[model samples]
Target: MPGERKAETMEEVDLLVCGAGAGGMTAALVAALEGLNVVLAEKTAQVGGTTSTSGGTTWVPGTHLSEQAGVPDKVEDARAFLESVVANRGGARLREAFLASGRAAIEELDRKTDVKFVAAAAHPDYLDGPGAAYGGRALGPVMFDGKLLGREDFDRVRPPRREFMGLGGMMVGRNELGALLSPFASLANLRSTLGIVGGYVLDRVSYKRGTRLLMGNALVARLLYSLRKAKVPVLFESGVRELMIEDGRVVGAVLEGPTGTRRIRARKGVVLATGGICWNRKIRERLFPAGTRDYALGPQTNTGDGADVAMAVGARFDDGGDSPALWMPCSSYTRPDGSLAVWPHIILDRAKPGLFAVDAKGKRFVNEANSYHDFAMGQIATGAIPAHLVCDAAFMRRYGMGMILPGAGNLAAMLKAGYVIEAKTLAELAGRLGCDAKVLAETVEAYNRSASTGVDEAFGRGSSVVNRFNGDAEAGGSNPCLGPVGAGPYYAMAVRPADLASSAGLAGDEFGRVLNEEGEPIAGLYACGNDLASIFRGTYPGPGTTIGPAMVFGWRVAKHAAGKLTDQPETVSGVMTDERTKNATL
Candidate 1:
């Protein structure tokens, strides 16, 4: 509604960003740091969206983080990895743009904002198939303190404190988890725990500090503090309901807020970074029918608001493929609020041993220990509808099965709900699952033989720590695959392949400009993060692959809006017509 109505009492800015997730915040920060007038809006009362709830890793190859950690990498190496994964499906030009711009964007944020990067030495590129880097490409943000943001700033923006499954906060990295688990390990762990407890007691006696906290909350707290110090205007509890078009360009947006609806006119353009449609049940069912009901890890605000708003303004979308939403098994316990809780660690632990996940037909498909993204895709590719994670008694006892403890009742409940099943024999378990008893028996026997010898002959189960971390660590035999469930009372859990989020949406160029049906840019509108088809297409190249591309595109979109991309030739033509543009605003 640009020309139809008079521009009365309009608030103008160089950039109006939708969503406050990693992409949105990165866009806002970059634009603001470039000395542009920027305003960021979030649907939830928080600045960090899924990023706050994520592992906070961004896969950036040949960056300072990797270099500092002495990891061998270059821009070419990163580009090669992208090419190998995306193959011909993702355009080489777009991949090149992402690779070329990634480091600069990251370095800019590090130099100008409170955002700091640390190298994740252990994270690897997703494809071990070919041309994959060994390590030191992924980067995670340094931990920050929420208290540093002060009460006022903290109150204005909500951190993802209530999003964790049963834990109550975001997921922390290995260092943080190690610290928590260390206290339960040995003398060192005991000493560390005592030290923390002693410190708490002393602080309590002196009335100097409150309760101690750890993990994801601490990391988000730090990021929020930095945002506050940067003076970024994060309009929390404000959702972008519509886009404002002017002369075939995305000039502004209509924001729905707690106070009222307000029109934000962007002098430059609007950046749609509101994340993907992970929480929208209709969209989830349409895209991933089998796992829709079980996929529950994403942010509630990630309902494709940015995508919907953009589509309303004549933007086109692309579903990369019929890729299923990534899935992880969750606890069957119903909370007082009737929400399903997921235990990610349990899936990680159980799949590490000789246990193998099978489809309804009781057949093995993927490497059980692969990243959640690969496993999810494998399930879809293998035609697995409601896959099952089958393990022997030794596997269950070794990994403690489902949730750590105090929540073991949840597993029992799941077993009773037909969400999980247990039987003394393979044939009995197959009967319960309605699969051929002989097929399942053979599958288990083969898997057990492989496990006993420490080799996963069928699916390469012993590939990554991610897989081995959940497997039977003590299984004997050369292959380590044949850990026989002859111990009786074998277990099987009905695992609905779930996702952290859906990866399909409006397709965009490297600059984050939404493209039309003809593969031409739709001016005035830009999209990034989950709102756009993932840069890696459907395959997750490595850890933080989602956030890394999101940040890169977010930065690129803002830069392009600021006319920084003038040096680069337009790879594609504009598809929006004058008539369509006028009609959209009207």
Candidate 2:
């Protein structure tokens, strides 16, 4: 039932956005652009949520950037792919709404704000299922010059976690990867490397963080830049303690900030973009699989605040699939500063030849070149609580494991730190890993044979053209993804299934309206980003699946509030205990 939203006793804005990630910021921006009074609040002192620590890739299917990148994508093709991959866990309508609005979201941000993006030349859908594009669909925010944010603004922007950044604070994007990997490969590489290093050196002279913002950090900076242009004050250290509902309609929230507690009212509604429930221990223990760990390299502030608030006000949870969260294999070690250096094995290591995950039996159980999410899922299926990511001496020296960059970082220091386990032979490595030596040797031989050829008969490693996106082209042996770990010295790292993002979230309608357990909207409450139930349920479809929907639905929520709702599918996301059941999109 729609109740009177006017709250005379509280400070009010036309729109109140909670969580300042890409989604929340987008909603605020849209409202501000439309001349609506909007206020943004973040739980942490920082603006960006998990998005600041991510690659900021959004899985928007059709866009001008895709055309510019020369990848032809059709809505039907993407729809087909989603149907095959999502498998009805989240229903068809929600996916359709996402597909329809995704491109428009990017376009609006590009046209109305400083947010700009470019399609990856070769990103692929995680699953080699139907409607997958080799590229042109996944888009990353174009790198932003931190100087444009100015020193004060740069200082305000949250820095990427130290372990995620290079040179302590410098951010490197896709454009700089090749140069950083092989500085002597070309004059361009040399020059680019020098430029980055020089800039970092100068930046360290005054700024506490690197001025070169890239990837997700860059994306957040861009959004913040736009917000600054709009003159929106994003209140930090302000966490929502409770949602105030009158006659079943969410009308306001009691916020706890540094100064004091205040009830803030929203005329339009509140946008919840709190990045997932990755760090919620109680939820993870109760709902997720046994032995599931929080080795997340994402924002630790994700305590399910948004979901909790909404659920307290009647929103339902969606955690009824084979898995309850998006998976990532993470490696972590404590730093001398008492902070943990956690590394998410999303990319930069896995697909780069000579790496394989093995169980205590020392046998390979999965395709080495598969996406991190799928690889982690496969690990969980095998019940391998601690899988070993093994590689040879040459491979380790050439391509380092998590938090241990190749051809750089102190390798011996890392080994001594137990960040990596080292041995002179497979037998010794197997002994260290408590796996059978003979079986490990045979597994290596079988894998090496496949590496000698271009085919992995056992698992078809690198069979998909998309696998090469995270692989190395310089060493395109029989397969660029395959390399014999037949060398004398070996290295291994213990990896576990880490929660990357939550697939289960609060249910919502097409207008970003929060839905109750009975499948009806809770008027004046909306959710975007990881706060809302994932459209694909627990399956990770492609790069930026999290951010893409977040931005689009955030846009949808704002438009709906502003009376500017356009062509949007009527149905949205909600609880579905069974994937086979239709109307999975509530």
RMSD of 1: 6.1
Candidate 1 lDDT score at position 50:
67
Candidate 2 on 1-586: residue-level lDDT in tens?
A: 2223445545888889989988899999988998899999998888888888888888888877888878867766888888888775654656666766677777778788999998877888887777788888899888788888888878778888787677788887756776987899999999999999889989899888788888888899999999999998898889887887787778788788999887888888888888877787777788887668556655777788987888887787777365778878888777787887777788778898888889879998888678878888888888877788988878877888887777736788888788889899888998999989999999999988888887889988888866776778789686778887767788889888877677878877767788898988888898888888788877888888888888888887887788776343333343222321222122
Maximum-lDDT candidate: 2
Position 572, candidate 1: lDDT: 35
lDDT of 2 at 205: 94
lDDT by residue (1-586, candidate 1, tens digit) is 3223334435888888888777777777777766788888888876667676566678777777788778756766776667676776755565666776777877777777777778766666656645467667778777554446655554544444242322333233443344444466677767765665565555354332322333334434554555566677778788988787666677788888999888988877888888777776666667665545645677766777876777776667666554534344443444458766555532345455546787788888887677766776676666675677787766665544554332243456556554457888888989988999999988877876775666777777766544543344555444333355556687776555566655678878767888866777877778877787776666677777777877787787777777766444333332222331222112
Candidate 1 C-alpha error for residue 493, in Å: 2.0
For each candidate, what TM-score against the reference? 0.85, 0.93
Q: TM-score of model 1 relative to the true fold?
A: 0.85
Candidate 2 segments whose C-alpha is farther than 4 A from its true place: 1-8, 181-186, 566-586
- On TM-score, the candidate that comes out on top is 2
lDDT score at residue 492, model 1, on the 0-100 scale: 76
